[model samples]
Target chain A: MHRVRLGIVGCGIAARELHFPALVQLTDKFEITAVTSRRRERAEDFASMVKDALGYEPAVFDSYEELLESGSVDAVDLTLPIELNVPFIFKAVEKGVHVICEKPISTDIENGKKVVELSTNTDKVIYIAENYRHDFRFNKIRAFIDENTIGRPIFVAWHLWIGMDKSNKYVQTEWRQRPKHIGGFLSDGGVHHIAALRVIFGDIAWVSGVTKRVSDYLGDDDTLSTVFEFNSGVVGNYTVSYAVSGKQYFEIVGTDGRIYLDEERITVRGQREETINIPNQNTFKNEFEDFYRVVKHGEPNILGHPVDALKDLSFFEAAIKSKDTRIEIEDLLRSTTPD
Target chain B: MHRVRLGIVGCGIAARELHFPALVQLTDKFEITAVTSRRRERAEDFASMVKDALGYEPAVFDSYEELLESGSVDAVDLTLPIELNVPFIFKAVEKGVHVICEKPISTDIENGKKVVELSTNTDKVIYIAENYRHDFRFNKIRAFIDENTIGRPIFVAWHLWIGMDKSNKYVQTEWRQRPKHIGGFLSDGGVHHIAALRVIFGDIAWVSGVTKRVSDYLGDDDTLSTVFEFNSGVVGNYTVSYAVSGKQYFEIVGTDGRIYLDEERITVRGQREETINIPNQNTFKNEFEDFYRVVKHGEPNILGHPVDALKDLSFFEAAIKSKDTRIEIEDLLRSTTPD
Candidate 1:
């Protein structure tokens, strides 16, 4: 019956398009108590929008620390750009505030390890908002696999290709094109597939990959091909390309059948083929609802726990290292010391 | 229409399971005039089965050369073990007989090139029987791509895994376990996927691969992971493993949509997703029918030509070389010289 007061950092596209809409929809469960942005004008504009949209007024801050220090807020949603986001997560955790941070979790292993270490000492929850797992279509794929509809997955092939809107001014201004800011495509985008793979195939033991810069205009790579060996002994290959021109699709191949998920539907094929139309469930809304349920009831398995986030961060770090050194990622995962 | 008289060499599982049954069903278009095997009893048994199955009598030969020299057969179906099959194909082409050899076409570059050269001089057709292209589901995928349902393909990820059958008598055989006989797993089983890739994504310009023999008892590799770059700038990652305990499946990812095909059906996903139930059309039967059509009428553009077979053979050869030297495969189509 009690509502959790929330603070949101980063008033960018993700916050504007996903978090704002989701927070407005889950009004009964969560109250948007505070908002912050690097730019004070944007923060004021967002606060006004939230006031008009959700019918409540909350404190607005020009900095994340101000929002974290605000006594009215229960949790912080760190949707800030990666370079700022990593340090912000550590600060929020140290302040004894539960944090739900956007993914990659941290762009590199050192910072990621620090976040993991910080979570162990803190009673406040640290959850990574990896919405792909919460996305109902992908959840159905995991469900079908667990129910033995596919009868023990032996191979998983994922293809994610999202075209950039060249005409969008916001995209042109974003830090996504810079390796220093985003850790390149594999770290930012590939982490989703890696996290999804972990959820579907279990622990990944080793990986090998090649990253290539397709266009001279971008300093970082837009394409990647990676192979992963799961602890279950199943091998998976993933192809991620920002240069590719279309929608996303994925397939999970198992002993008895296969499950194919795309933009619009999910299909399971075995002794008989069945196609299921997935109704448009706003994944961001679902993710926030799950987060709300977990926080309200002390449920540990909602959204993705800190440990799950750490694993995905580890894999992302490993992929970047493998690409950089041109060494098999198996070496990185098995190494006793940091590369 | 004049029926094409056919002779089958090797009388092995391929002949018994695929070729013989296909010939029986298409009796109006094909006539089985002779059969041969290394063992006289096996040859006699096949000849009897062909006669009983089609209600037509065919001569039995103890030696392959005897069948080739018989002068009664118009074409030779080389369905023997891959090693014997390669040499038989060369001899068949030398005898000016059209050939439909079960794949790999030949295990090594030297023999495969020889078959290609022999085909150029003789007016007889040489089809490698790459049945996956003829597979109804793949054809549907091709149609979807042609229709621009998925738009232009930018990346393709294929997973082909066949579990080693413990009870399979063929595994007990010696040649299959030896690298020289079948060129290991990449050349033996992987050729099918590689050939399929060529059919979907143009000619491969280069490839980099890692191969591993997971089972200590097996002399040949059970797993192979490869990345190929096609001439059209489309890049692909392929994983072919006999070590994985599961079924076979593949997907073609394009800019606008995707087509995923497995054992049971084909699913095309674009702005929307639709699953097309493939009624278990026998790929071998369809392949033979195409071969029958090519022989009776003429080679059509879509139903694979001799050049396509040669290109597939070249890619297989390059994959083997790349695996052995740990080098990237380059310029397969241009080189007439064998490695």
Candidate 2:
């Protein structure tokens, strides 16, 4: 079996901290062949780091197009800012290269649908790197729900409250400070939460939400309180705030029992109580492995499909727009999907 | 201080288990002089218990009307079922007796408003015993919010998930099994949550909610997920479930800090973290003391006001009824208030 040659796009903190560490562990399935960034020095630094980890020096391209057209790589790993995702995804897929782009597919529904439409016109996999979908704890939770371990999930309450101060690396980014997207961090970090919910409860059917700007630095809306009704007959309250720090937990309550998830623990309360300490998982690595398998082994695309990321974008956009009325997720998609 | 002569109505579990024990502690402030129940034996048993505690035997009346008219009490403590609350309240107030009734004031908005109207026509205090208002933990929370301990309040998430099984005394009652009111236990027990929120914030400006029947035994709708917008510019998600047992916690997130409340503790995270061990106070006793002061000492009514309880009922009803649309709490109140 031959390894899939990969190029890294956008050599910012996510590329350096998250993706590079993950790529180091997948030397057998994936190899870093080329890299590109707006800042050529950062791309050079990334290439050097890749050589340090993989014992090879890859070409550093001046632009994403150069990386896509040079044929030095079979696929490109996109870690670009949110707004740049669509054009790069389209370029990679149209250029006949498998691509795993960072979430979301796009910041809004229209561009997300456009990317989805473009993916179907080709055989090259347009995988999305929504790492939350690959996180093992949610898989454990999904298995619990699938096995009736909690006696049918009736309700869910998920809260993500963290203070994104100046010291935080993500908070220091220019795009995040003045987000060009609809809901700022709500679309950026919030999509991961949506992806996790989709993994555990299926697609969201409808949503009603209220957004607040508790912190001026977090952009348009730093806080969102939303009620989502899933197609699987489960309703949940999901609130995400980048404004102030508080408890971060996701709880699912069922007829006979309840399941709770925090950052590092899973507590299941049924006839007997069980608390599982969730081990640290490199989610980016897991997603990359899935992307590699889908591209190389012709494995089925479940976790990395662009459509799943599109749905996540749709839910977040609908939540931002749903102030006083409930927005049906399917209707939002139908309206936004290009003919 | 002269002990206010109090008549006990409806000798059910709440009256026997809750009010009786409280009355024992308040012998100097309130004297149980007359008792009446649908069951003559329960009323006689209550009188004997009062005699054993207060060192005097009180008259046992065959009917609430007889007890009111016999001049055996200056104020009546009504511990009847939900449907009986409005009528008994009207009878006692019209008979010129100050009454402390169990929440809610009524099952529906129309009846609740009628009781509110009847209270305005006389000087006899119509106190609604919503013990959550008297619960000191909420007062501590209210103080924290008022002191800006958490800065300007941004959001709140309150979850109440408890199983009402056969062994639970309240679940064994015939009325609870076959509830005639709207939302059943939602209004029966959910009003306390609304009361706690009102105490912390202010009046709920509007509400959007979805209710589910997770347990067949808990009544029409055993689960509720609601987004409440307070008039004071705070928005919150308050979900209550009587179908399953999970964590019962109320969290308030503000611009500067956050306050967390569980069943046994209050955790405040701000410039300095504070964990308050919430000592148990007999909330019933606290409310009785307030009732005694209001009836005998001409003290102001705040905690036990009937209007406050009516608001609790209205909020719960609106949440239950607001399925596809948002319900403005003030509009609901205005529509129900009789001219």
Best by DockQ: 2
Instruction: Output the TM-score of candidate 2.
Output: 0.88
What is the per-residue lDDT of model 1 for residues B41-101, given as tens digits with 9 covering 90 to 100?
Answer: 8888998898778777789987878888989788888876677766777788778788888
Instruction: Report the C-alpha lDDT of model 2 over B24-83, residue by residue, as the tens digit.
Output: 998788888899999999999988888787789889999998999998899998988789
Per-residue CA lDDT of model 1 for A14-120, tens digit only, reads 88887888888888988888998889888888889888997777789877887887777888888877767668877887787878888877656556666666777
lDDT of 2 by residue, A41-155 (tens): 9999988888788899989999988888899889998998899998888888878888888887886777777777777788989998999998888888998878888888888
The superposed Cα distance between candidate 1 and the true structure at residue A241, in angstroms, equals 4.8
| lDDT score, candidate 2, position B69 | 95
Kindly report the TM-score of the first chain in candidate 1.
0.89
Interface RMSD (Å) of candidate 2: 16.8
Docking quality level of the chain pair in candidate 2: incorrect
Clashes of 1: 1
What are the clashing pairs of model 1? A246-B255
